[model samples]
Target: MRGLKDKVAIITGGIGDLGYATAKRLFEEGCKVALFDLKQSDAGLAKAIDALYIQVDISNEEAVKLACERVENELGPAQVLVNTAATFIFKGVDATEEDWQKINSVNIVGTSFVTRYTVPQMIKKGGGSIINFSSVSGFVGQRNFATYNATKFAIRGLTKCWAYDLAEHGIRVNTLCPGYIYTSAFVNSCKVLNLDIEEENKRASEMHLLNRQGQPEEVAAAAAFLASDDSSFITGSDLLVDGGYLAK
Candidate 1:
């Protein structure tokens, strides 16, 4: 919680449930927040928190570069960067090259690009925190989830390497690995799959030791800790906000 006030923070995929929740928490903590996403958000959502919202495809390197620059110009050089932008594509060995390309472009490459540009600003500020979102999927196998799982695993790997690379400049890089969280995306996916919502919810809840899916705010709290000086001693580590799912 310390070292957050008036700090510039960027949350990629900011319009989404998790990202938006994190942004709101950071804003409440007195940080200047910026939301970057491919989709346009309700103006009121950003206005409600007095945060900047930019619609940009993180997968596009040039676009990401410009967007980071805009954040610097508008919100000041970001002292915190949360790479929450991701694309989900579930498939096993049957996954095609196109599926790999689509998911990898956004999940792996886009996350790297955003961090690439943001690191300089952080270095300029003499230090920063970078929270890369991984998942329980990153640490274990899942049925027909090779495409998505692979990228999640890669995020953990990247965070460790970046932690080492950035340490000299006082930057900390760590992975936030959360279990299934009850989000709008979960609801939408259930609708698309034509699954019974309550049944699916029950199924997901059973997967966690806590007997329920995690909430966006819960994950946001973990992220806030990582973004704040409270986690100053942690870096190159995977903080499991997984509701003991991995333990079970």
Candidate 2:
């Protein structure tokens, strides 16, 4: 919690769900934040954080460049980076190239690009933290989610590599693997499928050791620690924010 006061952070995909939660948590800890998400999220979150809204599709190079430029011009190089924006299609290996590319672009390539631009800034700032979002699904096999599973698994490896490479520069990298949470988008998805929303969610909670799905704020707490000195000695770690889903 100490030393986070007035620190700057860039949270890619920050205008929604987990990102928004983490951003709010960090902000509460007295850090300055810059949020990036689909340009569509600008109006909604800009008011919430009272921070600049960056219309960045992390998968697009030009968009990322422009967003980071704006951050530097307006605030400063971020001392923390959280890559939370992700998308995927659920299907078998019969999944098309487009499906693979879409997930890969946002989940893998986009995460890499954000870290690529921001790591140097952290180094310049004399060290910082990066928290990436992975999933318990990545650690285990899942049905009907080929593309997403692959990217999540890929992120686990990327977290370790970045930690190794960035450690010497004082930049710590780690991943937060969340199992399931109640988010509006997910609720809408389940509803669209006409799934018994309440029962399905209850089943999901039962699957976890804690007998409940996690809240975004809970995951955000872990992220907040990693970003602050509370985790000074930690890096190259995958902190499972899952409510015991992987244990089962």
TM-score of each: 0.99, 0.97
Best by TM-score: 1
Q: What would the per-residue lDDT of candidate 1 be over residues 97-215, giving only the tens digit for each residue?
A: 99999999999999999999999999999999999999999999999999999999999999999999999999999999999999999999999999999999999999999999999
Taking all chains together, the TM-score of candidate 2 against the true structure is 0.97
Could you give candidate 2's per-residue lDDT for residues 25-84 as a string of tens digits?
988898889998884774766677767778778998877877887887798888999999
Compared with the true structure, model 1 gives a TM-score of 0.99
lDDT of each: 0.96, 0.86
Off by over 4 Å in 2: 42-44
Count of clashes, each model: 0, 0
lDDT of 1 at 233: 97
